[model samples]
Every structure is written in structure tokens, then in C-alpha cells.
Target: MTKTAIVTGGGRGIGQAIVERLLQDGMNVVTCGRGAEPADLPEGAVWVQADVVTKDGIDAIMKAAGRVDVLVNNAGVQVEKSVADSTDADYDLVMDVNCRGVFNMCRAVLPQMSETGGSTVNIGSISGMVSDPSMALYNASKAFVHGLTRSIAVDHGPKVRCNAIRPGWIMTAMAEDGFALANDPKAAMADALARHPVGRFGEPGDIAKIVSWLASDEAPYVTGECITVDGGMTAASPLNPGLF
Candidate 1:
């Protein structure tokens, strides 16, 4: 039987890459976004005009995905503001999409998943494990994601496996936008690149490859693990060269 997988916010960037990779892996991929269907949506994949922030939106995605063998909670937002500088709107937007979206998706899909066993691959961030200056809300929300991943694995167990991938600095549209906002985009890019031991930033495909494996039966025993795929960035010390 062809397994169905639903990925949120898959119109472009990391989500698009994951959708493409999963399609290559031979799964019937169904993806959703808040706006209209994307013109460049991958071949052999379905896209629903939906969002993960609302119950109706989630229901729409569920209806589109018929049977959910895999769910990738990739719809997220970031607010680059210090805790003291953050506004209520910032908190709500970040929490609604990043944390609540994942929560709702997991809750909605897990029951159907329990019927025949399933898996969830959440796209988290290395910021969740550590601190990122001016990204207090994003960091906190991702932490919630990591914690929820563990809880889901523990509670759902062998029937529904759940895991999170905390990516470091994938050069996606969002990342590019962040860099573009920097005073010196080139210098910012260089600084970020220097932090990675790999001497390069990550690509969407890098994260997508892991998502493909984690969502497959090959990783049956890999539940509740929040794997970091950051080109060894987290393994290095804060005192390593550049900061000084």
C-alpha cells in the first residue's frame, strides 16, 4: 500500500525539500500552506490550501491526507526579540505556529496513526537546546517541541514513533531573509559559516535527507531522539576562535 505523509508549510524551503525527498522515497506526499497552492509544488505531491494554526486548517489537512502514515510538523515561525522587548502578538504568533501547530498536528494524526502504526518527524532548531540572542520566543517554543516529542514517544510508544531534528543554520528563504536584514549580510553570512566546523552552512536537502530516513520503517527504534543535524556546530565550544 502507498503510505500517505502530510507535511505542513511545504510550499517552499525546508518543507519543500522534505516533500520532494519523501516523494522520491515513494510515499504519497500531501503538504499544506496558509495561502494558495504554490506554482512550484513538487510533482507527485498534493498541496492543500491550509494552515496548522487553526482547527479548521488542521481538519482540512487531515481530510486531504486520508490516511496518515507519517506527519512532519515543519510549519514554524520565529521572532527575533529579547524577552523584555517581545510583544503579546509576537508571543502568540510564535507559539501558535511553532508549538501549538505541532501539538495539534500530533494530536489529530496520532489516533489515525495508532490504527496502523505511524511516525512523526518534527523540524526543530539547535536554538531549542541552547540560547540564540534575540530569539527568546523561538528558542522557548522549540524547547516545547523537543519536550513534546519526548512525551509523545513515551505516551504513544511503539505504535506511534516521534522524533525531532534540530537544524543549525540551514540556508533557506527564511534564513536568507534574516541575513538580508543584517547590517552586513556578507559579514553575517561569513560569521555564521565560520561557526560550523564543516566550514559551510546547511542546505534544505541536508535536513530533508534525515527526515526521509526518520519517517521510514528503517528507523523503527529511533523514537524520542532529538537529533542535531548542524554540521557539528553544537559540538564546538563557545570560546572557539570567532567570538573572541
Candidate 2:
């Protein structure tokens, strides 16, 4: 029988890739995002219009699509602000969407998962383990995802297994635009490649494959683990900050 998976932020970027992957794997995928739904979603993929930061939205999604075997908490936004520039509103916005959003999804879904004992992969970031300039809020938010994964694995074990995947710089539309706006996008991307031990940046497929493996019996022994799939960038950190 096919499985059921719910992935937030599935409208675009890494989340969209993951949603497509799960559908290709012959599972039912329920995806949600803020405001609009993807027009080109997979035939088997269900798109729900919802805001992850609110409890009512979370409830609506979970109630409409029941029994999820895999829950990917992939909805998040990065706030580029230094300590001096950050305000209370900025901090609240970051935590509310990235951290609290994950919590609400888990709470909405965990009861069903606890009984069935499935898998959950939280899309954390390498920033969760490390840090970057002007990204303290995003970094901290990802750290919360890692901590939350550990908590779920510990509390719901023998039934549910929770793991986190910390991704490096992934090539996506938003990232592409950001790089371009930063001046000399290709050079910037190339510079990043030089610093990374693997000598290249990552793609969405890189993360999607790892996530699929973690959710399968192939990684049965894995739980409460924060796996970094950054192409060896996290392997050594005497690396460059200019490209980060």
C-alpha cells in the first residue's frame, strides 16, 4: 500500500522538490504553503492553502488530510538582520514561522504518528549547528528544529523516529535571485564551491534523496540524529566566511 506524507512549504524550493519526490515514490503527498498553491503540482499531490504560523490553519490542514506517515517540516523563512538591526517583531516573525510552525505541525500530527510509528524529517540547516553573519534569527530557528527532532525521537521512540537534515547552500530560484542581486552571481557561486570540500554547491535532489532514505527502513537505526548533507562543507569549518 502507498504511504501518506505531509510536507509544509511544499509550494516551492526544497519543499517542492521533496513533495514531488514523495509522489514519485508512490505515496500520497499533502503539501501546504502560505497564500497560494502551486499551479503545476503533481497529479497525486494535494495542495492546501494555509498559513503555518497559525493554529487554525494547522488544524485545517491536518483535519482535511489525515494519517501521515512522513511529515516534513520544510516551511521557513530567513531574516537577514544583525543583532543591531533586529527588532522584537523580527525575532517573533522568525520564530513564529520557522520554530513555532514546526511545533504546531508536530502537535497536530504526532498523536496519529505515535500510534503508527512512522518517520519525520525536519528540514533544518547547517546554520543550526553553526552560525552566519546577519542570520542569527534563521540560525536559531533551525537550531529549534534540531532540538525539536531530538525531543520527538526521545519521547515517541519505539514507535516514531525523528531526524533532521541540515542542508547547505542549495540552488533554487530564490537563491539564484539573491546571488544575482549580490553582484557577480556566478562568481559568488563559484567562490562558494571553492570553499566547500566537495568543490560544489548542493541541489534539491541532494536533500530529497537523503530525506527519503531517513524515512525508510534503510535508516531504521537512525533517530534523534541531525544529519548534515552539506557536501563536506560542515566537515571542515576553517572554510571561508565571504562565500557563506
Candidate 3:
């Protein structure tokens, strides 16, 4: 039987890559986004116009994906501000999409998943494991995700496996926007690239491939784990000299 998978925020970037990868793996892919469906979404993928933070939105997605074997919680937003500069609105929006959205989707889907042995792959960030300056709210939100992923594994275990992927700096539109906001985009990009020992920043496909493994029978024993896909950015110490 063909399994159905639902991915949130699948219109672009890492989520889009994941949707494409899963379709290549031969699953029926249904994805959701808050805006009108993108013109370039993968040919075989189903796109639902919905948000993951609201009950109505979750309902709409679940309705589209009548029976889900895998759920990828990829919808997220970040506010580029320090705690002192962040507004209350920032706090609400960050938590609503990053934390509450995951909770809502899992709550709505886990019961059905529990019946037939499924998996959940949440797209967290390296920010969850380490602090990034001016990203305190986004950091905290991802930390919440890591914690919730573990709890879901403990509670719904022996069947449903839940895990998170913490990706490094991928060259997504969002990351490009971050660079554009810097005082010197070229220097900023070079500095960020130097941090990755691999000599290149990550691509969305790097993370998508791992999500494919963890959600499949290949990783049956992998649950409650937060896999870091950062191209060795976090493995190196800042003190390392330029090894050319």
C-alpha cells in the first residue's frame, strides 16, 4: 500500500526539498503553506493552503491527508532581534508557529499514527543546541521542539518514532535575507562559510536525505534523537586556525 506523508511549510526552502525527496521515495506527498500554492511545487506533490498554528489549519491539512504515515513539522518563523529589542508580538508569533504549531499538529495526527506505526520528522535548528546572538526567541522555540520530540517518543513509543533534524546554514531564501540584512553581505557570507569545516555551506538536499532515512524503515530504532546536519560547523572550535 502507498503511504501518505504530510509536510508543513512545503512551498519553499528545506521543506520544499523534503517534499521533493519524499516524492522521489515513492510516497504520496501532501504539503501545506499559509499562502497561495507556489507555482513551482514538485509535480507529484499535493499542496494545501493552510497554516500549522491554528486548529482550523491543522484540520484542513488532516482532511487533505486522510491517512498519514509520516508527518514533517517544517513550518517555522524567526524574528531577528535580541530579547531587549523583541516585542511581545514577536514572542507570540515565534511561539505560535514554532512551538504551538508542532504541538497542535502532533496532537491532531499522533492518535491516527499510533494506530499504524508511523514517524515524525521535525525540522529544528542548530540554534536549539547552541545560542546565536540576536536569536534568543528562535533558539528557545527550537529547544522546545527538541524537548517535545523526545516526549512524544517516550509516550507513543514501540510504534511511532519521532525525531528532529538540526540543520546548519543552508543557502535558502531565508538565509539569503539574513545576509542581506548584514552591514556587509559579502563579508558576512564569507565569515559564515568559514565556520563550516566542509568548506561549503549546506544545501537543503543534505537535510532532506536524512529526513528520508529517519522516516523510513531504515531507521526503525532511531527515535527521540536530534540529528545535527551542519557540515561540521559545530564540530570545530573557533580557535582552529585557517587550515588551507
Winning model by TM-score = 3
Window of ten residues with lowest summed lDDT in model 3? 235-244
Ten consecutive residues with minimal summed lDDT in candidate 2? 174-183
lDDT of 1 by residue, 108-185 (tens): 998888878999999999999887777899999999999999999999988999999999889887787667767898
lDDT tens string, model 3, 1-244?
8889999999999999999999999999999999999999999999999988888899999999999999999999998888999999999999999999999999988998888889999999999999777788999999999999999999999879999999988899867866776889898788888878798999999989999999898999899999999989899887543645
Model 1 spans with C-alpha error above 4 angstroms: 180-183, 241-244
The better-scoring model by TM-score among 1 and 3 is 3
Instruction: Give the C-alpha lDDT of model 2.
Output: 0.85
In angstroms, the error of model 2 at 175 is 3.4
Ranking by TM-score, best first? 3, 1, 2
RMSD (Cα, Å) for all candidates, in order, is 1.6, 2.7, 1.3
lDDT of each: 0.91, 0.85, 0.92
lDDT of 3 at 164: 97
